[model samples]
Every structure is written in C-alpha cells, then in structure tokens.
Target: MNINSSICNLKFGLFFHLLFLSCSNRDEVKGQIPNVLFIAIDDMLPVLGCYGNSTALTPNIDTLANQGILFMNAYCQVGLSNPSRASLMTGMRPDEIKVWTLKPHFREEKPNVVTLPQFYKEKGYATRAVGKIYHDGAYHQDPVSWSNPSVLSVTRDGRGHKYVLPENYMPKRSKATTTENANVQDTAYIDGKVCQAAIELLNQLTDSTFFLAVGFRRPHLPFSAPKKYWDLYEREMFKKELKNPRRPARAPDFAFHNSNELRGYEDIGELGVIREEKQLELLHGYFASVSYIDAQIGKLIAELKRLGRYDNTIIVLYSDNGFHLGDFGLWGKTTNYEASVNIPLIFCGKGIEQGAINRSMVELIDIYPTLIDLTHGEMKSSHDGISLLPILKGKSSKVKSYALSQIVRPYQDAINSRSPDSMGYSLRTEKYRYIEWRNTKNMSVFARELYRMDDALSEKENIASDIKNEALMNQFSDIVNRIRK
Candidate 1:
C-alpha cells in the first residue's frame, strides 16, 4: 500500500509539469502574432524627407521611418495605378494578370487568386479599408475581407469642419464646372475623410485583431490645393531654372514622349493650350498638395498612438505608384522611366529594425508575401514574388540585383503615331537603366540606353557607342526573355 501511494504522487507531479509546458507553448504562439496597419498614398513620388528630398514637408512619414526600415530603392512593377496596385495585392506581375489598363477589374481578370487582405482575414484579422485602396475609386474592396468598405472624399465626409477654396482656383478652361463644392482644400482632401473613418473603425473594435488599410488621394491631377498650401512654395522660385531637358539618345523616343491626354490638347485650337506661367502654377500646387497630405498623416499617426496600438501594429506606408513631376519634359505617368517606376516603401512595426535603409531592388509584388510571412498567415497559393521578410529584418543581405518595368499603352499604339503599336520593356539596376521598345507585331525597335545614376540627375546618355560596354545590351535582352517567360 505505501509503494502504490508513492507511485501515484510521482504520476501527478509529471502531469502538472506537462500542463505548465502546454500553457507556455500556447502563450508563445499568441505573442508572436502581430496586427497590421497598411497605408497607401496615391500618385506620390519619393519626394519626402526620408528619401533625401529636403523640400518635402513629410514629418509624419519621416518619424515612421525613424522607427522602421525604409526601402530606399523600392519600385513598382508598373507605374500606372491599376497594374501597380493589382500586382502588389495579388503577388503577380502585371503581365501575368494581363492587367495593363485601368478599366478591367482585378478579380475579373484573376478570379481564383488570394489577395493579401484575404489571407489576413483567413488568419482571423478583421480587415477593413477606407478611401482609394484600389485605383480610380471604381474597384471595390473584396467583400469577404473588408467590412464598411468605402472610397470617400473629405469634401463630402459630412464632418463638422468647413472647407473653402479660392474663387480663382478652378482652371479657366476646365470642362468641370466650377461650383461652391467642386474644389476641396488640400488639407481637406479625401485622405482626411479616410483617416476619420479609420478612427471610427478602431473605436468600435473588440477582441478581434484588425487589418486596416488607409488610402490617401491627393496631388494626382489638376493640382488642386488650398491657398495656405500654395503659400508654402513661391512661383518665382520655379522661374529661375527654366531650361530644355534632354534625354538619353539611345533610349527609345517613347521614353521622352508624353501621354495622349497631354497631346490631345494640341488639336483644341488654342483653347486648351497651357501657358508656361500656368504650368509653373500647377507645379506649385503639386508641392502644396504633398505638404497637405503630410499634415493629414500627422493626424492619423496621433490617433494610432492614442489608441495604444502604435507599438503592436505593423505600419507599412507605400505609394500605389510613383508620379512624373515633369521629368524629361514629360508631364505625366505613361512611360517606363525611373521617375515613374520608383516609389517609397517603409515598414515599421514588431520585429522591424529601425533606421535601416535597404538599397536592394524590391518590387510592389513582394509586399503580399512579406505581409503573410510577418503575420504567420497561411500562404494561399504560389506567388511569383518571394517574401521580403528576411530583407526587412536585415537577416538576408539582398533582395534582387535587377528589376523590370513595362508599358502597354493602347492609345499610343494607334496607327501612324511616332511609337505606333508601342510596347516597351525596361530593366533597372543599382547603377544603370536600360530599355527596348517593341510594337504589337513583335518587331524589335531596340534602343539601348545607359545612364549612370551617380552622375547628376541620370541624364539619358547614349553609351551604346562605347565598345567597352557592349555586354549591358545583352544583359537587358536576357532580362526581357526571363520576364516574358
């Protein structure tokens, strides 16, 4: 009887120890999961304090960078809105989805694909989005993942604050009617509305983890901003350096060509002709719009801190795509230029190393896998992009040495144009940029361009003449072959 009692006591001791170990294991797994707060800016270039653009007033983004890893060389798969956003969400290249234009819906093209937000939702996150998370305000958020999905503009937010625009703010020849409500102050743009909605969503949260996407729309077109923002930059400052900008001779003519929207004004019989002073005014307005967006970001960041979710939430800020601020004498995004492709991407949150600037070549497509890996969410399907987790943590040394971009402008491909039937492919590296154009019929209108970015402003110089550098052309061709496959 004494021996049996002693054995029973030993068995109970082992049982208690095993129970403790099981509890500890569950706690460990729970602690590893993280919340995500993804922010997107529309048509914004890397003209921020973090990206070495001293003139940009982006205090909120700069502060975010101070606490996270800022990708200095991050680029989009394509420059346009639909393709760039689609590629990032689905982990597929634009060509893979056949989404080169703004009109086709993403889900319609790739019906069975699993989006980043959908993956997070499957992992028990209550995913929500406000404002232009996708392009053109027409693409709705996936209903399965997003609750209270909307793309709202601040002017119509029904908020208490009164927004006012100057009487002369409207363009003299704009087709849009100038009304009391037509022009919204830059500080009062759609992003402010989105931020308010996000605050409301967070306020109602409970035990469930959240995935919130806040999209800001400003500084894209028409260059509309409040009078105060316009006061930030002087028009006289822009008048000092007017000169004819030249591009690389070896680069295709399409590289320097403006979009059809700009060229359509030529046949309007001087009615829509934009004067030089007017162009400078537009430039000033763009700068003001950027500053206005920065101020709105300041508001959102404060709200996050107030909720006590600042430390635990993974904050990622990225532009849907980069914009062309009159580079190469071009006014807008439709070309495969570096200015149009390169975007600013910053990640700050749990396990993200602070103040680290990664110069490795990374694309928007990588964002999908990176988020999955960070959250330990289930991988839905095979993706063309690998996770940027190792690179973000400073664990992996490099992401990629080369990046590719493409252009498929149907309007520009019409018959008898300078670049008739145009489709071009570009390759970018740490030190150089190269491109080759092809028509719809598959004719090689090959133009070899080489630019040394270390030089001032990366002026397009035709280095094809230099016999010593013949290997670069072959390298570009090989990249095209791989991308096509």
Candidate 2:
C-alpha cells in the first residue's frame, strides 16, 4: 500500500479501537466525552505561587494547582511563540513543521497535517478559539482548527493606548514606553475582552463535547495591565534578588543577543543593558501583568463552575514559551536557557490526581497525544511526542528520559566574514542540559554548552569544556546527533 493508504488503514484501526474503548467506558464517562477547557498563556514563566515563587500573587493559579496535577519540569519545544505554538498544536517539532520564525505559518510547510483542535473537530467535538489561540500575526491563525472563526480584537500597535512613562525617564532605544499601567478597567484590555467572550461562549455552549480554547495575550510585551493590577504590588517588592549576572564565560557568541524584541518599542531608545531602576519597573509591570492574567483565569474558572461544567470538563493550562526578565542580560526568549524554555503546565479534571506535582521531564508536544488519549479520540497521524495519559493516571511515574528544544540563530563567521544560519539543539535530562550549536548551512558543530542541573545558578555556568565532563559530553553529543538526524 501507498503512504496515504497506510495512513488511512492506521486511522481506521485506531477509530474502531477508540470506539470500542469509548463504549466500554461509557458508564465511567457518564455516557459522554468530557469537554475541554484549553487555556493558553503567552510568554509566562513558572512564577506562580504554586510554582514556589512567593513574590508572585497568583491565588487562582495556585488553586488550580491544588485541584490538578502540575508538571514541575515542563519545557517548550522552542523558545519563540510562533514556533512553539505550531509545534505543540501539530504534535510536531519546529524542524518537522519548518516554522522557525514568526513570519511563516505551519500550513505553509505541512498543509495536510491535523492540528490538536482540528483532530478534536474531526472526532465530532465543537472546537472554538478565542484570542491568541495561534500566533496573533498575519496568516498565522489556522482557520480549519476551529468550529467558529477565532475572535481577535487587539491590534499589534500596542492596542492604540498611549503609555505614560515616569518623569525624566529618557529611553535609549525608542521614545515609546515599554509598559502601560492604564487606569482603565479589565475589559479595556484585549485579555479582559477575551475573558468576557469565553464566559459568554461557555454560557451558550450546547454541544456535549466541546473544545474551548481561551488564549491570553499579556505578560508578553509592553507589559500593559490595568492600574489596579499595578497597585497590587509595591514597586520596592519587585527588586531583583540576584544581581544581573554576566553571560556564561565559556558560552558561544551566538547564544546572546541585545534583546531585539524589547528594543523595538519606541520607549526603549538603546540596545544596551537596562539600568537597575528601569529593571525594577519592568519587573513590577511583569508581575502586574501576571496578576492581571491570573484574575482573568479566575473569571474563566468561575464561569466554568457557574455553567456546571467544572467537574466533567478537562482543563489544561499551559504557556507557549517562557520569557526572560534580564536574566543573563537577556530580556527575551530564543536562547537555549532555562528561563526561555521552561514553561508551566497544569492538567485538572476527570481521572487526574489532585494536588500532585510530577517532576518528570515533559515537552509541549506531548499535550496533543495526551488530549487525544484522554478524550478517546483516534489519531490519524504519528506525533513526535508520546501520550502522557499513563503519568496522569498514576500508572507510570515517567514518560521520557529527556526533552529536546531547539533555536535558530544567525552566526557571524570569522573565516568567511559573513553570517550563516545555525541551529542550537538542546537536550534537557534530569540532571544536565547539553546544547550543541551547529552551522545549518554545512552541518558543522560550532560550539557546545553542558550545564550541571544542580540549581538555577548552574544554568549560568558552562562546563562543556571542563576536562571532568569529557565523557558526559561525548555521551550527550551522541544523543544529540541522533536527535538531529
């Protein structure tokens, strides 16, 4: 048989298996498949109260953690929003989807691939998307993935709200400020509007099985939140606990950047490191944004309860990728660092353990298969990640030994005096992080980074060149080579 025929046969077999399982477990599931409440947060790190960050005021998220299984070692496939979302949604890797940048959509490369929501839709689930479900860019949202058109109300131009910076705060990059503590209500922002829309949808849902995806676009950039949220925390409380550390001494030159994303705003005028005072302000804005988003989450959960869908609905909360707030002098993602790749993932609902924290290493791609297994839906295609249902049901304590993440960078070559494209492949095992930067053009290795995962501070130190790690480096290099192939 041909490739298409083989896929059809596999799907046909899986469909019958799912049908049999669904019928067998009909009593356990109340004769109905569980609805899905998918929540996506943008550029959020694991800085919630449940994540052990005392400074972060996230009661709603903490409550969710108490009611769900929180994966303590979840990592994104990539450190950028577009690529990370595409990879997770399609159950593929960045390389498989060929979406390394924000400019291209995954369909451009894999038009026939079924996305996570599209898979649910195929299995008779009404899928609805609101806010930034996919990347909020031109040609980024996948139309076929939703039962209704995705709702988007915000513009890329910072929502047209003019920000007012502090007095005598001269920006070095652009005159436009990077933060806005607007004195408007929650509904005045896009995320607030998204919450309202989601609540309305939840109230109006008539389908037995529905996949409602609510994406929040805050804590990403411009750090725009209502003044009330800003008032929740004192500015002094946002002081940096760790001094801005220098980049890893043995790190490759391509591993660092001048934080181009933050500098693009008009309020930022320079390409250098931000001052200490400004860093404090940024931290306050970031925390405020987190709290603001947390409030919206509270609204969502409350609505879910009001609609009487709280117990039966399978709720999954995740961030596309982690963000950096001046850690290692980098203010944005796209690095092979812990701050950029380590994200938050929580799953709560039917069949999941409550108040449990699993320390097994997991990746965003595992979400698609896990949802499929939980919903007893047929999988028509293969996925880069395996189903995490075993771990959720307490049947297994581990899924995979390591998680992989990659980032593409432009490397300036001294011999050729020209910049060539390179790919950084990182492997995160239980106790170490090994990264190999390879010149994509010629497939030659440029640099390597091996970090001992004893603590957070170990991420800032590169021990790849240390003689004591030669054997470990060789072992990790072999694994990375196989992964690259």
Candidate 3:
C-alpha cells in the first residue's frame, strides 16, 4: 500500500484514457456550464426513499433523486473518513494518496495538487464550502482552494441534545458524555451550520453560476441530534427485523471480522450494542439527521428557485462513505463489506433525465470527471472514473461494469503485530463482492472473502474451498491488481 504506487497507477490510467479519447472521440460539445450544488453527507447509507428502504425518512433527497437520476450502485474508494474525503477532493484513490487512516492530514499528502473547488475556481465559479466538509477534525480551510469557507466553533460540537438519554445511557467508549452544548438548535452538528451558510450564499451571491459544496456531519459517530429528531421515532414501535437474520450470506470467510476498535466497543458491551431497540434508536437518530439536513436542502432549493437558478443548477448528492448500524456484529465503517463500502449517490437538475435509475458500478472518484463533463467538455483523460454524463443523458448502458473499494490497515495495531499494515481490497459488481487481505493471520486464505449479494446475510460462506469458483476469483483478483498498482 505505497502512496507512490497509487499515484503512479492513477497517472497511468489518466494517460491511457486521454490517449484513447484523443484517437477515437468525436462530437464533443462545449456550453454555458451549469452551476453546481454539491451536497455531501457524512456516514450516510442508502436508507432514503429512492433507495427503497421504507424505514428511513428523507424527503428532500428523494425529491432530488426523482427530479434527476439515481445511481443505485455507487460506492466509495475508501471506507474510513479522512481518506474517503481526500479521495473525492483530489479525484485520486485512497491508496494512491497513501491516506489510510484518520490521523493523516490531506495537506501532507498533496498540498499543490488542484482541489475540486480550486478546479471550479480556475474556471470562474465561486467555490464555497461550509460545515465539516473536509475530514472530521480538520479546522480552518484549504487556503489554496475555497473562495469562502466557514467552520463551526468547538463549542457547537460540545453541546447537549434536546432529547434525554436513557437512565443508563452512555457513549460506547467513555463513562459519560464528554461534550455538552447549551444552545437549543437545529442542524445541531457541523452540517447544520453548513446548510445555513449555503442558504445565505444563495440569497446574496447574484452570480449566475457557482460551486457550492455543502457537507453535513451527522449520522457519523456519537449519533446525537436535536430532541425533535430523536422524538421522530419511538424505540418501542420498531418491529421489523433485519432483511437477513444471520449476516449477509454472500462474502467468503475473509470479509467478516470486526476491527480491533470495534471488538473493543463490543467487548465493553456497555453501550453501542446492536440490539433491536438500540438499532431502532440509531436509525431514528440517523433519519432525523437526514430529515434535518433535507430541510436545509429545501431551503437552498427555494433560494435557487426564487433566484431563477433552479433549472440551471446541477445538484449532486452523495455520502462520503457508508455506515454499518449493526451489520455483521459491526458498528462502524472500517471494513470492505457492503455496509461500509456501498454509498448513496444521486444527481438532479439541468440536462439530467427525470426519474431515471442507473445500476452502473460507479465510484466517488467518477464525480470529479462527471462534473468536468457537465461543466465543460474538458476532462482529465487519465483519470480512472468515466464521466457519468452519458448515463445521465441516457446514451450509455452503464458507467462501469464493476466498482472497486479498498481498505488498508484493517486493524490500527491489532492483527499481524510482526509485519503490521495488513490490507484488504474488495471488488463489487451488480451481483458479488470479493475481498483479499494479506500479511494477516485469518482463517480465510491470505485473508480472502467472496459473497453472493443476492443473499447478504447468513455468514458469508467460506467458498474459498470450492474450486469451481476459480473464474470468479480470477476476475476479482484482476480488478484488485489493477487498482492496487
């Protein structure tokens, strides 16, 4: 998992793609680029209405998805927080940037590289970001990128919720709530602040086009929201069980283990247990956060409509990465399982056909080039992601046949104490998921997993023994090799 290797791989792909396009491409159109409203969510899974989850509530997102195209098979390049965010900003994969964990800062990886916002700025769009748009703890702003950036004060994060915790309520790690807030607020977390800022910009900025990146940080960890959001769901009311009782039945032996940290949480077993009641509570909090965030989007859209910009703006909503409520005895996203890798991605507005759904395998990295296509015909031909513009325009069968997700350093300091740095790479298609880990001491091969997504629960059967699956294994191996290099 060398950073240089990742960069070289991206550079090679960019070069090859550009070479191919230059020789065969025809009929490229350039036009008045539509304004972009890039809405990003933190740790949000596809629990929205458009994704077909009846439990979760999200009106604004659902409306947006209906107004345009919904990407059913979108995924993130990395599973963790910081690296996932960094990959989106740089249009580079996590491995290429060598940003494996939350500890590393994006600045240290590629300070001079052009950021997504900076790219828009270069092309004359006023780029702005508010809330927890970057990594979790990153403060200030990317001085080289944003035209306007605002972050909520620490006091905002250390606030109390309007809802009361259970008599025995406590965080998973510590004895009690570490942060407290005095303000009774909506958009309580960073995303709330971001929404406010975006709405304000829409009112004041008279510019015909702008790049607005509004990121919300809720539904992440310590899942706390305002009391109203908490009150939205009653724990005693939830009766439906997980679609699969035994763990999704597809993946092989390697993909199903908790991280050392997760094991620690479960071992504490005091709080954050994935009990049915707790799962209901967590889902309630998540839905409320999404609903709260959706209200903000509604405000932004209203402003756009009032300003006569609604029809002209292209709004893309996506989650940086997915979250696992209690799937596979897991609470967070640090693995390559479906819950951790597959994310919600939807596009709306200007030139996109309405109510269309595409099941193409696409990654967050494709977003960079997709915008480039939407804004202008210019594209970094060397990038691994293809512009989804074709799919949006109803001209292509799918964006890519397969999506790739990778996780490096599965355990911070838990497994393989001698060699350290055990890594896992996964490939997801319309039907299957395959994961491979090395330098690890796990029963599943050098640490391998293969699952049939049709039945995602019921322990991922250890199919590593079935010699009949050789062709399947090779196909996945080839994808991993290309992505790894």
Candidate 4:
C-alpha cells in the first residue's frame, strides 16, 4: 500500500490527459455564446423516475432528463464532499491534488490550478455560484474562482438550518428529530432560498451569456422539507423490508464507512443501533426531501423558460456523490460500493442530443471539459479530463472504458487529524465493480472484491474468490497496475 508511489504512477496518465485538454480544437460560436446552467445537488443518487426508482417522486428531474441525454453510469472521484467536489471542479483526480481528506484545500496542492468556473470566467463568461459549490468553507471555497461573491452559509457540522419548526431548531431537549415534515412554505429551508437566489441571478443575466451555478443542499441530512412533499409517498412504502439491509456477503469490513455522518444527529439516538420503524421514517424523509428539491428545480426551469434562456442555455444537472439508504447497512456515502459512487448525470439544452440514454461509464471530472466543448469548443487549459464531445454528439458510445473512484478508510472522524492506514481504489466497468484494498505503506493489494453490477442487488455479494472469475480479476488488475506504471 505504498500510496505515495501510486500517486507518482498516477502522474503518467495525468501528463497525457493534460496535453489532451490543452489542445485548441473548438468551433467558435457564430452568435450569442450558449449560457451554462450548472445545477449541483448534494448527496443525490439516481432515484428518480427516469433512473427507474419507483418509490421516489421526482417529475422535474425526470422531465429534464427527457429533454436531453441521461448518463446511466456516472461516478465521482471521491466519496467525501470536499475531496469529491475538489476533484470534479478542478477536472483532476484526488491523487493529483493530494486532497485525500477534507482539510488542505485542493488549491493548497496546486495553487494556480484554474477551476471549471474560473476557467470560464477567464474566457469572459459571467460565472457566479449560490449554495454548496465547493464545500462552503473559508479554506475549501476558492475566492479567486468566482467572478462575483458567491452566496453560501451552511453549518458544515450538520447541526443547524436543518429544521423549520421552532420546536425543532436547536431544542433544549435531547436532539432534534432526524426529519421534520413542517407545514411551511418552501422558502423556510435553505434550499428554497438558494433556488430563489438563482432565479433572481438568472433574471439579471438573461441579457448576457453567464455561467450560473445553482447548488441545492437537501436530501443530504436531517431530511427536512415542506409537508406537501412529504405527503407524496405513503408511510407504508418504506415499511416493506428494505432489500440488502446488510453488508455484501464476504466483503471486507474496510470496504464500508463508519456512517458517523448519519448517526451524529441527535434524534437519531444511539449511534450504534436504529430501530426498523425509525429507519422507515428516515427513508420517507429522504424521498420527501428529494421531491422538495425537485419542486425547486421546476421553479428554476420555469424561470429559465420565462426568461427565454432555456433554449440557448446548457443545463447540466449532477451530484457530487451518491448516497446509501440502508444499502449494505450503510446510511451515507464514504465507501467504494455502487450506492456510494453511482450518480445521476443529465446534460440538456443547446448542442445536447434529445431523449437519448447513454450507458457509457463517465466521471464527474469530465464535466468541466464537456461544457467547454459544447458552448465554444474546449480551450487549451491545465485540466486533466477529456472532452466528452464524441459521446454527446452520438459519434461514440463511450469516452472511457471504466470509471475510477478511490477513498481512504478510517478517515471519517476529522477534527482529531487522523490519517488512513489503507487506500482503496475501485474500477467500475459496464459489467463489474472491482476493488483492491491495498496497504498504503507497501502498495500491495491485501483484499479484493468483485460485483456483477448487472442489477440492483447484483452487489449483494462478492464473487472475486471464485476460480471461474480469475481471468476477469487479472484483466481488471492489469488496468489498475498500468496506471501505477
């Protein structure tokens, strides 16, 4: 697990990709340049009607998916918020930025690395952001990346701004309820205000070609939303036994996160054990929060259409990372499992194909260059992601063979300033999600797991130990080894 050596090996691929990103191969727009509407949803997985989640009510996202291409196998570079967004916004992997943990912002590693938005700003696009774009911390949010002051004020510890009811807001009682179906307007929550702010910004920028990033913070924790959204699903829906409520069969313990993020809330009570009935409540809250965010998106979409920017603007909706709703007995994202890495990526409006489904493997990092390619031809830059013009143009089925995601285990509880003993790297292909847990000191693979990834429950067990799959295992191993060389 000599992680440092692996980091050095990653540079080989990084070097070539950097060259590819800096090439001038874009076609200049003939008229008004296409505006970019970047919508980022926190902790959102592909649980909408378009993604085939029967229980979740998300008409706005489903409708947006119908307007363009929906990528079925999109992934994030890391599971944690700060690291995941850092890698994506910079169009680089976590290893290249040396940001394995939340602290020491990506800029600390590469001081002058131009972010996705910053690159657009340099190109004369009015880039502005609202809500959780880059972790919302003084250290994590790079001030130089924005053309105007961004609006973001979140209680990073998952404590406040989660409840609308006065009784639930930092109550003197033990802990606040994990969910609040409050009878209040949408503006009572932070996400509602964020959506409003974005709409106002859009109104002002309708006359110009602006890159507006509207980020919504919901369905992440405390699952608080308007009661109307909560009424969308009946309580009986979550009571049915959740499929695979336990870890994968024979999967290593290191492969799962501690889930301290979910357990930290007060009403959750007992960090170790949660009752089945309570789990159902949490599930209901998650669905309702998703619906709540969907409503906000509906409003944003309507505003865009009203302003006449819908036709000429490119709306790219994606999440930093996927969440686990009792999958593998894991409640949150911080693992290499399918539920943690698989995200919903939809590209719509202006230069994007209509009503098509792309089953190719793509990463969050590819988005930076994809926008550049669609709007004004991608420019020469320091990014490490390849432009996805081929896939979007329907010329190629896929841009990459597999998606890569990695995480450092035993690094969840920060503030103590702890380091990981092992690093896990997982390669996701069309057929399988393979992982190798290696020693960070020696760079030797200590444990391995392989999932068929054919269906939802295909990851319920690991099949790498079977001799029949040894050839498949070696083939995946070679891909991982090649990156190190």
TM-score of each: 0.81, 0.88, 0.81, 0.89
What is candidate 4's TM-score against the reference?
A: 0.89
Alpha-carbon local distance difference test for all models: 0.68, 0.82, 0.68, 0.81
lDDT of 1 by residue, 1-485 (tens): 69899899989999999999987875555456677888888878888888897566678889989899998778887777777787788888876776666655568768888787887877777888776677754443456546445535223222212223443234343322111232344336455566777778777653447788888776666455556666776777655423234565665564555434444332222233345675566567667777777777777778878877777788889987776655566656766777788888999998888888888888777788788888884455567776788887889857677777777645443212323355667777788776666665665655556666655444567676687777877877787778642
lDDT of 4 by residue, 453-478 (tens): 86753387789899998899889988
After superposition, which runs of candidate 3 have C-alpha atoms over 4 Å from their true positions? 1-31, 139-141, 153-156, 160-189, 241-274, 413-420, 440-445, 454-459
Relative to the unseen true structure, what is the C-alpha lDDT of residue 242 in candidate 2, on a scale of 0 to 100? 35
- Which candidate number has the best lDDT? 2
> Once model 2 is optimally superposed onto the true structure by TM-score, how far is the C-alpha of residue 485 displaced, in angstroms?
6.4
How well is each residue in 156-185 modelled by candidate 3, as lDDT tens digits? 323332122443144432323211222346
What lDDT would candidate 4 get against the real structure? 0.81
Model 2 earns a TM-score of 0.88
Q: Per-prediction count of colliding residue pairs?
A: 1, 12, 19, 8
Name model 1 segments beyond 4 Å from true.
Answer: 1-31, 137-141, 151-188, 237-244, 259-276, 377-381, 410-420, 440-447, 465-468
RMSD values, in order shown: 6.3, 9.6, 12.9, 13.3
Candidate 2: tens digits of C-alpha lDDT, residues 1-485: 89999999999999999999987786465436889999999999998999999889999999998998999999998888878999999998877777776667888889999999998898788899888878876568888998888876234544422233443133433235678887888987788888999998887784356899999988888788989999999888877443465787678877877777787776565566677788888889889999999999999999888777898889999999998888788787777788899999999998898898999999998999998888885554568887889888989988898889988775222112223378888999999999988877787887889888857633867889899998988898888776542
Error of 2 at 345 (Å): 0.6
